[model samples]
Each structure stands twice: as structure tokens, then as C-alpha cells.
Target: MKIPKIDKTILVHLALFAVALIYGANYTIAKEVMPLYISPSATILMRVLGAAILFWILVGKKRLILSNKREKIILLLSAIFGVVVNQLLFFEGLARTTPINAALIMTTTPLLVLMVSAITGGEKFTFFKIIGISLGLLGAAMLIGSKTVSDSSLPFSFVFDFNLGDLLILLNAVSYAIYLVIAKPLLKKYSALSISKWMFTLALPFVLPFGFSDLGTTNFEQIPTEIYVGLGYIVLFTTFLTYLLNAWALKSVSSSVVGIYIYLQPVLATFIAVALDKDSLTPTKLIWAACIFLGVFLVSRK
Candidate 1:
């Protein structure tokens, strides 16, 4: 069957939009399942394994070649940074922080990637990009501030007042930025699905220990069936489908455009949080959302 021609830009944007929506909803989904059936490590492991299996099934008989020792080494390292470490930090951070904070901090990944690229001579740092990144940070700060002010019912004491969840999400952003930079060169040689498969397979070993430990603490028999179903959804949609679509989008569109989509994540996440989880959509959130969106636009614009 012949494939129909599609506008690459439109397809990329659409895919990115879908990814943002799935990612946004994931915050609540993960929160619900993470505490019951899985630990951070286990959740990460399931994601990688599930995604890899799906990729392998789709790729069929076309053998993905590693080429040489150097390529294999690079792939290994890419898996370590991109899949293993990045996911480990992300899930653990999610466990500590609220989804809103996590989503907000994740907006920094693009700026961080740009900085890494500039320092490595992969890309030049432009003034506009700097301004854009600053805008993103300002937006995130506004959102954080709004969240802080709105939740006045809680105690003001330092120990009890602050949410550790946001900090964890920030770590995921940093790790993800590092992964993007490290994985860029490899993408030139391998297809995104191929790269994803190898990375996840290699990451499996590293993540397994954590997954097993989390399982030990939980009573598997006592957990509700819905929690497993939620886990399945996360693995299928958030982990597997989202990653594949993102990889395809990256291949088809400019990285700057792809980066801009990060802003969409928090917006979608907030809506999902409100609609499904019954989280408040406060004025403070709106303010922060504006700041973040402005920052993303500035950073990613030509």
C-alpha cells in the first residue's frame, strides 16, 4: 500500500500536541498508581520494557545494526543517560513533588539542551534564545508563587510548608536535557525507533533492581485491578506511544519547534489535573502559565 503524503510540519505539531496531552494527564495517572502497585524504579522499568517490546514488534525483521564498538558504546551511554538515569530521576522526583511543579520544571529542558549544545559547539547561543529561556523561567516562577499563595491553609513553617515534589521534577528536567545533548549525535546514525529500542533494552538492567524493591514493599494481591490498568495505560500511552511519536516529530521538525511544545505540556497537565483530579485552577496558576508560555515562545522563536 502506498503511503499518503502529509505536511511534515503539521504532522509534527499534531503529534507533539497529542504527546503534550498524554504527558499532562500522566501526572495524575502516575500519582495514583505509583503509590499502590509500583515504586518509582519499577514504574520506570515497566515503561522502558513495555516501550521496547512494542518497538521491537513494530520493527519486525529489519535488523537494527550497531555498526562498530564505538557506536555500541555510544548507544550504551545514551541508554544510560537518556533512558535509565533520566527516567529514574523523573519518577523519583514525581514521587516527591506535585504534578504541576514537575510539569513546570520540565519546561526548562529546552533551555538546558540549548545551553548544552552551545557549550559543545553543536549550536550557537543567540540573544533571542537567552531571552526566551529567561521568559520560561519567569513563567515557572510565577506559577510556583501562585501555588504558594493560594495554599495558605497549610502551616507556614519551613519544614511543613514547602513541597519537595517540585525539586524532584527539576532533577528530571536536568537529566532529560543531558540525555538530549548526548543522544543527538546518535540520532544522525540511527532511526529514532531503533535508538529508543536499544536505549530501553540497555536501561532495563539498571532499572530492574528498583522495580523489584518497590514490588517487595507492596502487597500485590491486595492492590486493586484499576491500578494495574492505570499502569498499563501509562506504559502504553505515556511511555511507549508518546516516545515513539516524539521521536518521529523530532525527526520531522526543527528542534526549536519541538522545544516550544514543552510549554504545551504544563497547560494540558493543568487542565487534566483540574478536570480529572479536581485540582484547583487558581488565578496564580494562570499567571505562572502565562510566564511559562511567554518564555517558551521567546526561546524557541526564529
Candidate 2:
């Protein structure tokens, strides 16, 4: 049997777009399922468990090699940040915050990536990029300070107490940025599927404990069919498909190209949320979004 080769250029573009689209709509779809029918930890458990099963099914039979002890440790750490903490924080955050805020706050990841890259001496930050990073932070702070769906009565608490959900999501962004940095070297040694499968498998121990109680409490028979569909979307498209597409794209395109596509996520997320009436566009939000977008453009426009 022969697999026909598509043009790598076109396939790369489609893969990038697919990643953005899956992630963009996920804000609302994931929000709809969590807390209402499933706890955040339970959602993380299902997403990883389901995706892990599918990844193994796709490639589990093949033997994978890790070159050294350091690589193995890095793999474990990657699972912690990338799979366990990253997901646990994101779903919990999304449950408390509006989809718009979650999406908007996520735009800060690229900047975090750059800062970590600079700190690790993987890259240098120019003065202009620093300013852009500052502006982006300003925008994020503004967005966090703005009224959220979860805390309309306590707008100022974001500065003092901090909206737990928004804070968790921001932390999730930082963890993801760190995961990107940690996983880069491993990608050079292994295929993405192999690395992803192992990482998620290792993550199960960490994820299961937090989720077990919630899983036990969930009334599966009472859950609506629509929520199940939303969960399927999260497991299949957001987790599984997006990872494959991203890994495939990285083989052909620069990581910077992949990072640039993140800008689309917030836009699509915002549009979907607004259209669904799950979130509304406000003057402050518009102004802050502009700042963040412009800042991200400046920082990312190498």
C-alpha cells in the first residue's frame, strides 16, 4: 500500500489552521461541559485518558527509543507541565472565567515563550521586543481587571484577590510555554506521536488522583447527549487532532510560524463566543484586545 504525497506547503497551512480552529472553538465547547456535568479535574482525566488511548492505538505497538536518562526525565517533566498541570489549570480556569477572557488571556503565551527562550539563552530579546512584551502584559492586566462573567460584583478583586479562574489560566499559559521549551530538544530525537504517547501515559498518575473523586461523583446516566458531543469534540479535535497536526506542521515549517498561528485562536474564540451570546464584546475589552494584538504582533514579528 502506498500513501499519496500531498504538497507539503499546502498541508502545512491546513494543519496550522486546523490547530487554531480546534483550539478556538474549544473555549466555548469545553466551558459548556465543565462544572455543569463534569468537574474540571474529571474533564482533564477524560481528555487525556481518551487521547492517550487513541494515540496508543495509532502507534502504541511500535517500540520507541529514548536516547538518554536526561531525555527520559525531560519527557516526564513535559508530561507534568504539558499534559497534567496545563490541562488541569485550563479547564478549572475556563469553568470560572468567561470564554472570552480565557481566550484573550491565552494570547500571552507567545510572549511567555520568548521570555523563557531569552532566559534560557535559546534566543535574545531586543529592546523593541521587550517593549512589546510590556505592552502585551499591560493588555493582559487590563483584561484581567475588567469585569468577568464569574466576578461581576468583584471587579477590583482581580488586582487584590485575583480571580482564581483567570489566574489559573494565566498560570496554565506559563506552564505551556515552559513545556514548549522543554519539549523542543526531545522533538529532535523522537517523533511527536511517540513523545506525546509516553508523556500522556506518564501524566495519568498525576491526573487520576485529582480526578478520581470527581469521576466517582458524576452521574453518567443523567448527563445530556449534547454534553457528550462537546466532550467528544474536546477529546478528539482539541486534544488528539490538534497535537497530530501541530507535530506534522513542525516537521515542515518553523516553530515561529506555528507560534504566529496562535493569534488566530483568540480571534476565532472571541467571534464564536460573541456569536453564541456566551460572551459579549465591550469597549474596554475591544481596547485591551487591540493593545494585546498589537503587542503580540510587535513581539512575534521577527
Best by TM-score: 2
Summarize candidate 1's per-residue lDDT along 246-297 as a digit string, tens digits.
Answer: 7777676645556667777877777787778636655555555666666666
Candidate 2's error at 71, in angstroms?
0.8
- What's each prediction's clash count? 9, 0
lDDT: worst 10-residue window of model 2 = 154-163
Model 2, span 59-94: residue lDDT tens: 867877888899889999999988898999999889
User: Which segments of model 2 are wrong by more than 4 Å?
Assistant: 1-6, 148-161
| Model 1 weakest 10-residue run by lDDT | 154-163
Q: Estimate the lDDT of model 2.
A: 0.84
Question: Which number leads on lDDT?
Answer: 2
Give lDDT: candidate 2, residue 53: 97
- Report lDDT (CA) for all predictions: 0.73, 0.84
